[model samples]
Target chain A: MTDTENTPKQTALYDKHLEAGGKMVDFAGWEMPIHYGSQLEEHHQVRTDAGMFDVSHMVVVDFTGEDVKSFLRHLIANDVAKLKEPGKALYSCMLNEDGCVIDDLIVYYLSDIHYRMVINAATRDKDLAWITKQVENFSVDIAERDDLAMIAVQGPNARAKALGLLDAETAEKVDALKPFYAYPMGETFYARTGYTGEDGFEIMVPNEEAAELWDALKAAGIEPIGLGARDTLRLEAGMNLYGTDMDETTSPLISGLGWTVAWQPEDRDFIGRTALAKEKAAEKTQKFVGLVLEGRGVLRGHQKVITDNGSEGEITSGTFSPTLKKAVAMARVPVDIGDTCTVEIRGKQLKANVVKPMFVRNGKSLLEA
Target chain B: MSNIPDDLKYTKSHEWVRDNGNGTVTVGITDHAQELLGDIVFVELPEIDTEYGADDATGVLESVKAASDMYAPLTGEVTEVNEALDDAPETVNTDPYGEGWIFTMKLDSMEDLGELLTPEAYTEEAEA
Candidate 1:
């Protein structure tokens, strides 16, 4: 048996990847496709054209109860009451008692009693355990949907291609779906969401229909992208990977995710509000920033960042951006550090310019330097 | 994939050793190694005149994905290093067997070549 079979999981499109000659790699305990052929070409395709990714490995958890909204308001760091529209989605981080992030997720409000969440695959077990343990007091039902498969179609022409593959009724409903919005068709759920920083739709379908939908999308000229391109694309777009950028041990303020935290409604109580409020009041010591290597060499994860004062931080995630043609990295450094720093690459310190991330968005350069 | 010339010997770690007509050998990473690494971004070659054993780590290859240490295929004294890699590191991924050569060395002894695998044997080992 293959490694994927030995595990307790397999994505619906696993066989399709094998047929396309995908190079498989072990990612977060799941066997996943790294690339089909040239990872560089795959990266370019998503930046220029349309591409589809089988993100079924990510766990989808559903919640249903009369007190669902109240439960979420306390369980998440962000205020979910802001999602007034039925199909609107809210991006929030589930934090521990100490204000450290457990996992960042998107909560889709379907109705007063129904909601859905998408969590990272690597932290599936931890996230499920945490949620299950906390739901004991609430009259809520939590179900892990292993029977569903998620396919993300992304790029400049992603919406058009995805619309072509969907049924007429479903396509019409999704045609005007705004960003961060989702609606359910007969059996498939379509969300106007993506990680590549492009206009796209993420479709959640039954396991039996996933392969057919994937084949239809491919026939419609949507290229199949693997995890290799996914990483570079997200990095270029300034999106954070859960484990690499932050984890249960790191606070959102220091990991460049403070924007997702909602501190409004002062009377409202959330899981990590007290700790976060204290940290914010005291003026934290750490901050997140982007770094671009001014000289030669690729900046990668775990590389040390040196300031004029001394070594002040380390790279969280780094990659040679295909769109920018230069190495870009996200690093956590002391809040007092300046714009210029040096990255220790292979024992030699190379000068780097610190800047706000989002280097590329919508096929354009967002960085000035 | 290009044919691994019969004249050269290989190690399971993917290093190729070409026995120069003289008592020297040219060492470079194989094509399979470069392909797996995607794009070579940086390479750290050993200092010239350094003596290394057949199993010693003599160099390092940093690709866009990960970093790997290149081992000395045979005992030798490093005679020349590929300085061109300083600006054109992608040569290791484009032409790993030719201009991408890491370093040349004067062999300590030619008998150690017997321990290396033939092209066919090396290919099988890599596929495994």
Candidate 2:
């Protein structure tokens, strides 16, 4: 994954990244910035003030047809019927026949006949194919939005800073937007959604104007962050990375995403309903939990987890939390696991405190100090 | 380009060594190595008196992106490890050649210094 045989593709802000001294790396076959200079500094900037990210690599898919609502309800694990108001968003896992997650995505209810989804960058090819295959019985037209670019501005002052770029009326309308909702102001669509657990807007703009908007945001004092900080921020926010936390072979029920499953109105069977129902009824099932290392050395992915009850598990994702000044991890362990366990880091047994998956939100630590 | 001090010896694995004029020598990763590693968050050092063969893994350095093994530049016995790095691993990124010196070792043989790479040779290899 580190090297690429073919030339990697670049986004609309490629030149802008180079001007900012971004260190480019091959991410999901695209040339993306890993950091401008210091990842820790960029992370702290986003947590304390405001920072922007070029997230244009993620695919934006739009579905338009009379059957959009019904099609979505049958496509993803979440019940899209709950998206009653236009511009409302639902986070869901698109599962396969065996009730295993294919990709986790956000779907917006634009209208009864129109919907939009934003999926992970790495899963582009497979996700498109899967969605196309499933739309065979519905009257939906899947339109992949390749002509657009996405930029996320996040932090304590992100919203106000972003709003400063807009006209008064448009800014007022955007400011009134509820969380998980979006509104199109002129050519740009603003969503009150982000991955960094900070108050912000994820704006989708035309590719040709992306650089101008980026420069404007830079002039407004929002630092340009890279993928390095994005990973840590999302991890600290207790959100799951699709490929790392769960994949095609892992069910959402055991992936710490059980809350995303909408099991109401039982007659509306989604793609993985039967298998998921069976798993939900099963007596013994492993659970996804968070771990805070209580010893030296950084906890990392694939490290062995030994529960106090003699059960075993593995860390799905782990890193040294810059905010907490300690190592934190998300792991899959036996349901009977207790409050604490040991992690094997290079043949050393290090104790760790088990807690709810979330560690931080909106610039505040959820964990008790 | 990374700074390559004329007086120091180098290893292909990126460790730079300073001969202390005695049986002991100080060692740390090069500026090029630290730049490649990015924002280092944690570091693990070898215990004093631990012996290792030339090219053996001696310690661990972890950055936000990944973890890397710090190899011994020459066969020696560990004399001291930088305790300051226990709290400030970023020192390696900020000043790799000074206070960030990872450890000092008592050489098994002073003749081993002849096998090390000079500034010119190290510059060629590093740029290549």
Candidate 3:
């Protein structure tokens, strides 16, 4: 039986996840929890209260030794020079030479000659290989830290409760940490960042300490979240998910990630800059837009979108938003598309309104286009 | 453990067919089916008066995980659909057997009922 099917990988907290009534599913080859019970409840829990997620499957890589800044400056679409302080984190999409997204990651400036990057779980092998190959003669050393585990505590009251599990000083430090910042207190790395569009922290702890922290969080009333809620929460927040929303063949410009590209300091060239410039000069036809289904049926990934002008597009990520109480999606449509379009679900066409990609932030609706 | 009612007939594809004792039969997903799909978000029912064959996909049930086909258990024409599911898909997850009935079909023939699996046989196949 084992030979007939490929077994999914388990993370450090796999047993804890199963113990909490988590329904396991194969996600990108990892045996991850889809939900403990209701996905909608978990989604609401994160928005209204506090919840924790075992996101340990994502890979963490560190760069050390001389000229690391220069190496990163040329590697990612966003400028590493933007990171000025220790533990400052910046989100960027690493692109290939043809201007397609290789992977979207957060790079943390640990110090002058050292930095850390966290990438998606599914793209680990290729992301590492790409970074390794590009570091040929640079004086930097690459270290993939598989020894650490990542846990995200998110929601309105998540930070205050997460502090209850840590030391007082650490709690104070966490309280002071600004959004989009990362700090190391003892062996734990706490970053005030999350994909859920809520006030929260993504904490990285040693593998041995992960389960204990999770148990403590659970004991303190922080709910254990699964990947099922994670997808809906991120979709409601209008965050882009890798592999689904954008892939190696899709450019960041058309994937709702054009804002992440830093075009200033025109002389500082990065990979795919020329291709992106050429695409920009030619006026890229496709653009990213948020779609809210105005009629029946669920709008799902790959559903055909028809603009008012008869142009065609496709939904990259779509879900039923629990907060907005409607079906919403992120789609790549023609630049000429108006504020509303039609989506073909099953055999019928349903009207949808096109808006900005972000639909919610900080537990409130950011519906303004 | 998933519930398998002894009185209802089941399809290998996870739908349940109940004999209404009249000329028609009521169709819905089983308890086991709803658990697998998780929190359902949308249900697209077949049009009234639409016809379908045994095991034909006539509608869709969508959850956060994916969209699955709601197959017709036997050859029949749809007489009524679960209109409540248009706004409340969670009925399928909360009450898969009762309120979540997908559609009712007027049978083409009493002979088509024999194609369905017995509850005992269905449990074995589903478990296996």
Candidate 4:
């Protein structure tokens, strides 16, 4: 789901999804498809072939002005001033004064005075408010790209399928884009990044072109994936869903996203830096870990985790990995906990071993490490 | 959508009871129940030989979306539970009325079968 179902928001591709027998659900604030028929089959399609996802529910905001980079340096926890080259992107979390996560976003440096940010739609209101408040004194203007729609073409053959739909010039430029890189050719912007833990491109184009582009990609043999497979794919990839894995009350340090934080350039002042430094010094109680159930039963969120070291935690995100053929979950446990824990499933305690994440990537299990 | 065999009795809660005519009954969830649940992920059926009341929670059925309790349709002593669910719970999604049958029980009170819904009534109620 991309938008909250209680609301009336719908993505540009909503009709197409429904036409294809998609099961609609409320995500963020929009009605989005969870799947077409079998979520597991869609999950397998992405791992083995190519799949396209409607990610237009995400908010794309463009910042233009002389002080755009300077404004972002104060708005995000990462050092965006370090992004020297155009078309380079950095992943960072915007934190509040209390050092809690406000939202995780991707910032792309388009030029010295232009930047583009893609943020979760669920936090659009608050994110806009926060950015507006910070840019008051800076020479920058923030504009939301409501006219744009995003589509993620993922899996092993995703690039080939996407390239087949683009013009020769754009295809050549897109072909040269490296991971964490983006390039704009005409009205379409293509980024060589995805959330599926697979190689792919995230294409952003005008709303009118979205449906046509999706149709072209489908014609090129890309499967139309829905939110159900998206969830399982990201879970298997060890990627965190914003609200489920972390929220306004949780810090990124304990949310299995510490690596995304850039701690260098102590002189660089970003939002929540002081509090994060203090928390870093004090050391937190929570630690995120991956759990694989050794016995029967599927693990799910809110399930109690009893560690061998007398520590307790709860599963934040759990699902049956289509790629792994077993139940896997991400849990936030006490920092002192050992490598093994027991999950309480239907009154029976099941043993689960803890490990680092990235359970599956590129159709291969990373759990062996 | 699946056909509820005229010979089987159903509970409003969606469990189907098939009479074995030997003071015993086979039990499983209705096809409509499985369709609403999408994909069956896990099932926790009662152990064999367990004594249960007519309305007792005999087991649990978990899907990718939610978890539901399977209620006993009649007072009985459990004789067997479907072990195939341990490997492939999706059998319930594929064949809810036949191969996905949950358990069998020896009826302690045969009169309880009269309180169960007939195939006709179950269909109308499910549709409504």
Best by lDDT: 2
Can you give the DockQ of every candidate in the order shown? 0.46, 0.84, 0.79, 0.52
Q: Residue A248 CA error for candidate 3 (Å)? A: 1.5
- Residues A139-210 of candidate 1 have per-residue lDDT tens digits of 999989989999999999989977886678877889989999999877789999999988898899999999
Query: Candidate 3, clashing residue pairs?
Result: none
Residues A124-241, candidate 2, lDDT per residue (tens digit)? 9899999999999999999999899999999999999989988899899899999999997666889999999998999999999999999999999999999999999999999999
What is residue A39's positional error in candidate 2, in angstroms? 0.6
Docking class of 2: high
Better of 1 and 3 by lDDT: 3
lDDT of 3 by residue, A201-255 (tens): 9999999999999999999899999998999999999999999999999899999
RMSD for all candidates, in order, please.
2.8, 1.8, 2.1, 2.3
Query: Which residue window of length 10 is worst by lDDT in model 3 chain B?
Result: B57-66
True contacts kept of 1: 0.35
Model 4 spans with C-alpha error above 4 angstroms = A1-7, B1-5
Report the CA-based lDDT of candidate 4 relative to the real structure. 0.88
Write model 4 residue lDDT over A26-66, tens digit each, in one string. 88778888888888788889999999999999999999999
Candidate 1 deviant stretches above 4 angstroms:
A1-8, B1-3, B20-24, B44-58, B75-91, B106-115
Relative to the true structure, how large is the alpha-carbon lDDT of every model?
0.88, 0.93, 0.90, 0.88
Native contacts, share recovered per candidate: 0.35, 0.82, 0.82, 0.18
For candidate 4, the per-residue lDDT at A229 reads 87
The CA lDDT at A336 in model 1 is 71
